[model samples]
Target: MKLENKKVVVTGSEGFIGSHLVEALIVQGAEVTALVQYNSFNSWGWIDSLEPTVKNSIRVVSGDIREYDNIKKIIKGNDVVFHLAALIAIPYSYQSPMSYIRTNVEGTANVLEASRELNVEKVIHTSTSETYGSALYVPIDEKHPLQGQSPYSASKIGADMLAQSYHLSYELPVATLRPFNTYGPRQSSRAVIPTIISQISSGKKIIDLGDVTPTRDFSYVKDTVNAFLKVAESDLSIGKIMNAGSGKEISIGQLFYTICKLMGANVELNIEQQRIRPANSEVNRLLADNRYLKEVTGWESRYSLEDGLIETIRWIDKNINHYKPNIYNV
Candidate 1:
């Protein structure tokens, strides 16, 4: 299961975690093929942010994950496929659930089926904490009942099931990485960390946000990416689903104040109606029991919340122009 000199295909290689994963793979001396969403301009998405040497080392292909034939073609000769391409905005899912179904559920099926046929050595499927909606108990584990509170979560649940079924029914060499609120540089503004940092750095005194009572266990992107490599290298991870997080939870209000303290900005909270999820659909708390990730891959959270937040703020400060502070990113 050594990654050195192995051929790896990373779907959604243009995204926050995906781009970081691609870079990490290059560091492991893997021959990388990065699959970004197709565009006329031939944009590489966040892969464009990679160091020239790392970017040049990877073979970039622009293709939609929803296309089965396209996925099969790109994945045929790949030894490993890290499937991450998806429509992730929760609010946007409310507006367009079908798109989520197509990209998340069907796209995952494409990855699993194609990987099975090609006999790829590994398939790293991405899952989310949202599938466990509002934590039934503190420090949620892999055994928790999945509750699809939103279309986004529902779509992910379907995708996760497909990945697991592939392993059980067909013995596909697949592992699922379930992350709790991964935040860092290059994360989209639709995410909470970036939203807070962008708004504060933009000098907005009144911060418009959704429900602040919900707590999240945040994992730094670097730590999460490292875990992906660990999972890929371990035979113990095959046919298993694991969690990644700091094992600590923070309320959104607390997170906001922490960011403000670091940025030295005094801000008032203005809860916006449009930004809030339906009351019934909102996940009030999320805390990860990340023991399984440790058991399988010897992974643990490497960055403290404040340390990660500070780094994120520094990144957002430099990339402030990319965000529209007053608008709801969804």
Candidate 2:
């Protein structure tokens, strides 16, 4: 499936990864429709930060993804659909699980339903590594038993299942691309990488954090976006559940220290009770097994953690006002 001259609809095209994916799609010569969540302010989220030339090339649509009618309308006449919209904050999910269910689960259902009805040629559904919870074993694969330790993870798991069911029951050309901790520019401070960078860039000596023992497999946003495009273009990926990651792991404590070193900041850690997840709900580790993705889509991570962190820190430094290091973001 060549993306050149193809009409593609990218849901959540205003978000962190979604915005990057939209830019990438345009570069690949796709006629892109970016479906952003509607707001009274007409805010476009990260899409607003994109270069003017790229932003101007996209057709932006504003609507609620949970509405089947809105989704169906946007999905019609598109060659491919990339579903990346969702409520992703773990802390916020704890506060309102129902909101996560509505957006992440039901919203995904709307996209799948629309794709099925319109007979879209391809659909690439985004899944999070968080859905695997703490790895019962290292190098977690698609066969790993999913454990929804947090409401956010649970909601993603629900979305992934819905995508799979659509493929199995209706023979929809859908694939689930589960990506590990994707970080880079335009990432909100709610995520760990941005949280640390925002605080250090703010010249804070004391960085507030939750438990830092938990480890994660991180991937750069660009690499993750490339994997999505590759999966969408590869006929071999249809009906497959694949992983996209660096196949490496780093603990939160170590990652924080590394960031401090990179930024030349001498920051001390302050354990904040409020920042911690419910003890039982915290996922202690995540490591990705991306062998299948490499074999099927011929995709591999291009950015190392250190290199990606450097780029992210640079972006956060220039856009310091976008983040409030003093407040807990979510």
For model 2, residues 1-330, the per-residue Cα lDDT tens digits are 999999999999999999999999999999999999999999988888889999999999999999999899998899899999999999999899999999999999999999999999999999999989989998999899999999999999999999999999999999999999999999998999999999999989999998999999999999999999899889999999999989999999999999999999987999999999998999998999999999999998999999999999999999999999999999
lDDT of each residue in 1-330, candidate 1, tens digit only: 899999999999999999999999999999999999999998999999789999999999989889999889999888998888899999999999999999999999998998999899999999999999988888899999999999999999999999999999998989999998999999988999999889888998898888899899999999999989999999999989999988999999999999889989978989898889998999999999999999999986789989998899998899888788877889
Model 2 earns a TM-score of 0.99
The true-versus-predicted C-alpha distance at residue 87 of model 1, in Å, is 1.0
Whole-model alpha-carbon lDDT for candidate 2: 0.94
Candidate 1 overall lDDT versus native = 0.92
> Where does the lowest 10-residue lDDT sum fall in candidate 2?
42-51
- TM-score (C-alpha) between model 1 and the true structure: 0.99
Each prediction's total of clashing residue pairs, residues at least 3 apart in sequence or on different chains, is 0, 0
- What candidate 2 gets wrong by more than 4 Å, as runs, is none
User: Each candidate: RMSD to true structure?
Assistant: 0.8, 0.7
Cα lDDT listed for each candidate? 0.92, 0.94
Could you estimate the TM-score for every candidate?
A: 0.99, 0.99
**Worst lDDT 10-window in candidate 1:** 320-329
